[model samples]
Target chain A: MMDFALKTFGLTKSFSGKIVLDNVNLNVRKGDIYGFIGKNGAGKTTLIKIVAGLLKPTAGSLELFSSSDLNKQRTRIGTIIENPSLYPNFTAKENLRVQCKLLGVSDEKVIDKLLDIVGLSDTGRKKAKKFSLGMKQRLSIAMALVGDPEFLILDEPINGLDPTGIKDVRDLIAKLNSEYNKTILISCHLLGELAKIASCYGVINEGKLVKEITASELEEACKECLCIKVDNIEKACDILENKINITNYESINEDTINIYGDFPNSASINSELLSAGVGVNSIIKKDKDVEAYFIDLMEGKTND
Target chain B: MINLLKADLYKLFKNKSFYICLVLSILFSYMGTMINFAYNSFSNAQSMYSLLQMPELNGIYMFKTSFRGGMLFYSIFIAIFIASEFSWQTIKNIVSRGFSREKIYISKLISCSLVSIIITFSYVLVAVLYATIKSGFGKLPSHFVLNLIRMILLECLVVISITSLFVMVVFLIKGIAGSVATNLLINFFSGDLIVLGITLLLEKMFKKDVDVNKYWMFSYNNIFASFSLSNDVVFRGIVVCVLSLVVFTAIGIISFKKRDI
Candidate 1:
């Protein structure tokens, strides 16, 4: 069996008696890009912080590889929790050099190769404070990989990046997972980009993880929704309920309803509505994105 | 442990405030020795009678005068280093990198103490060398080595403890402004009041003989006093140094561990 990269049992944390994470249990398997999705203030950052050993959990047990052998294992784990943690006064090369020195990695060529990977090899002599937000972010990721970490935990890595920068990071994450075979746990608010890259997912809401699934299973579960525009939604619902036997539908308004499930029979439904004297305006098939799936999960309406 | 020490030293070297304090120390100590020699040489000018009541220009007096300004400056410098790490949020990064908090705390304490110790020792060496050149070393006292070593070690322990106190303050507030303001206030008004006031209150309450100078880290009279040769004084200085180190180090460690850094 592949090693379990990270595991937390009954993890809970509170500050000033206010709960930040309430009984959170997390499992991250090796060689998987597990996208951790949550809204703002949903304890995503807190969970990452605890795992990184930056904050002690109030009521939980965390055990990594034994410290005696941790140099071999822990040296392979990298992280960037919340904001990019780097000295703004130092150059990108200097920052990475310091990280490498901390890890006892003395290879200059390795540092250069890592910088080349992040496309920051030309940032020579330029302080991090002078770099743009995108450059600084890329440099931070490069720093995380200083020791050739086998597992990388990145929290909101693309929080403030532009579309291109987001794409760059998304591609980098994919490359890291696929090419490098690194077990990655990334928390991001941008579900759309996360959906494109993540192989597995954990949906957290209100400080509780409601669901975890593989990408293929999520793809199958989030079936297409048919957006139907009709003059009378109630009549359409009646027709769908009676003749079509379709209980999977939502009424958008008095004049429109979303028909989902069994998409091949859409033409039949249109003709059926026409024959039933129901004025059908349009029917559009819409695939639920990560956000819609998360909403469904939160509302307890997710497809099993 | 060596890596930890190297990291601490790296940080200390990078900080500009430490360099500025170091330069001030060297310059002031040199000036202090030169000025005394010049005064003695010009005593025949009939202008030095008004300053006759002043204490003798000894090695301890010259060294203290030269280094006192830098000592005060060193306090602020150490405070700034401790505060800036938290203020800039770089400490979170370091803590997250899996360095034990206790190790990090000890590293800082070691760095601060080393700086203080080195500064004091260098000042004394300069004062002695300059005095020997200007006014022929008059048979160096037998206890000179013992007392000077003890004095420097005492200053190191006291300054390190002071810096560690401010480290806790910085950790508590998690900001430079809050830590610096609170420390300045406490050091200037509250700390002295607590020391002198408590000592005086106890003396009056119990009709005991209390040496006010003995109760505080600093003493104005002691700074300018003549250095007499005595093994007892050196022994007492060693005890004071050990006590301060123990007390301050314990508090510093406990406070750091309990902090939310």
Candidate 2:
């Protein structure tokens, strides 16, 4: 069995009488960058907070490092939930030192190293209050790394960053997972950005875990579909359905049809259409990206 | 628990509000002494009843007066220190780092008590130094110093009790302005006065002379006054202080643990 770094079963949360998360089951294996994708008010932060031990679930159970005692296991994890929890009056270095003290890490050298890792080595006594949003986000990430935790949970870690800041954090997250062997569970609404680094994804919508799929499985599930344009689309569909024995296809418009599944012989289909007096105008393969796949999952077009 | 304590202490030392509180408390204590000295000098000059004729410069009187004068600033200090955690969202950070809610609450309690004690003693030190310089320490007998120590220790308990109450407020209100406002209102205005008012009303309604000291546990003046009274009253005061500390701390811890933040 692959050792799971974090797992939640039937994890639910509610504020007052409103349900925010409903029976969400999530899993993050060791050494995987698990992307938690959800929209606003989708309970992404709620779930992250519950896993981070900052908030307790109104119902359900969670396991960290395969241990049912999440409180004890929380020491092995680090988190940055919602906003960066920082003392504005303290400098970035001081904030990291405070985190170090909280985690009981005695090494003075790790502070500088983490600052350098987060590209904040030159903050130089400037208080966090004066730092920009990007700088604050980077410092929060650096703080999360204070304990050298095995698991890192970042909720919208790059929410308001510029393009460069986004890329920098993306690269840093990838490096932390691949190079440092850290298992990361990151939540973000930006599917494209998350797609770049996430090894697996958990889609949450309306306070429910809609789907969980590995990146490769999602890639396969979103495989390219062959699109064909013809003068007589109905006759082309008849030929594709009866002659070619292809039932996994949809008529897009009056002159276009999309064929799913493995039909490597596109020329044969065109030839078959032509022989049936259907003029083949164009043939193309459209690849579905992560964004389209995510939309499909959110809209309940695909089975979980 | 040790790590939590260290982190809390580190934050306490780094907090500018704590320093501001220290400075303000010291200045307030010195200002009280200087006002008294000026009054004594003016009274002595006028050949009226000299203010120095009153036994107010001894260690016991100075400790009591300075501590009482510093209580307002002490409440503010607790409010700022605890409420800033909410304002800054650092409490969430601490909670996320694997510390139990009880541990975090206890750590804050210990750290706040430590800062309160430091502030209290700093005030006491300044008051004593001023009194000695003005009156030459000749009137401060050995027993007076001993009683001063006893009162200071009892005053520390009262400070801790007040700190616990503030902690409960911060956890309940969970905001800087709300916690500070509520803490000041209770500590400065309504905490003891309401209790005393109710006690007097009951005494009048019952048509019997009731020993109001028993119900004056929240009243610092009464508690401190009891120190000079019978040992039984002092024991009762100490019990009340300890009970307040325990009750407030329990409420704070339980409420904080159950809170969503």
Candidate 1 lDDT over A185-301, as tens digits, reads 999988888889988888777777777888998876566778888987778889989988889887867887876666546799899899999999998787876678876776556
Which regions in candidate 1 have their CA more than 4 angstroms from the true location? A63-75, A225-263, A266-286, A298-304, B27-52, B56-60, B64-69, B122-139, B143-159, B182-199, B219-232
Q: What is candidate 1's lDDT per residue for B65-154, written digit by digit as tens?
A: 543334544555567777777765666656666777777777777777677656655666688678766655554656888666655555
Q: Quick one: best DockQ, which candidate?
A: 2
Q: Give me the runs in candidate 2 sitting further than 4 Å from their true place.
A: A227-286, B40-60, B141-146, B190-196, B218-222, B225-229
Q: Cα deviation of A48 in candidate 2 (Å)? A: 0.8
Q: What is the TM-score of chain A in candidate 2?
A: 0.83
- lDDT for model 1 comes to 0.72
**CA-lDDT, candidates in order:** 0.72, 0.83
iRMSD (Å), candidate 1: 3.0
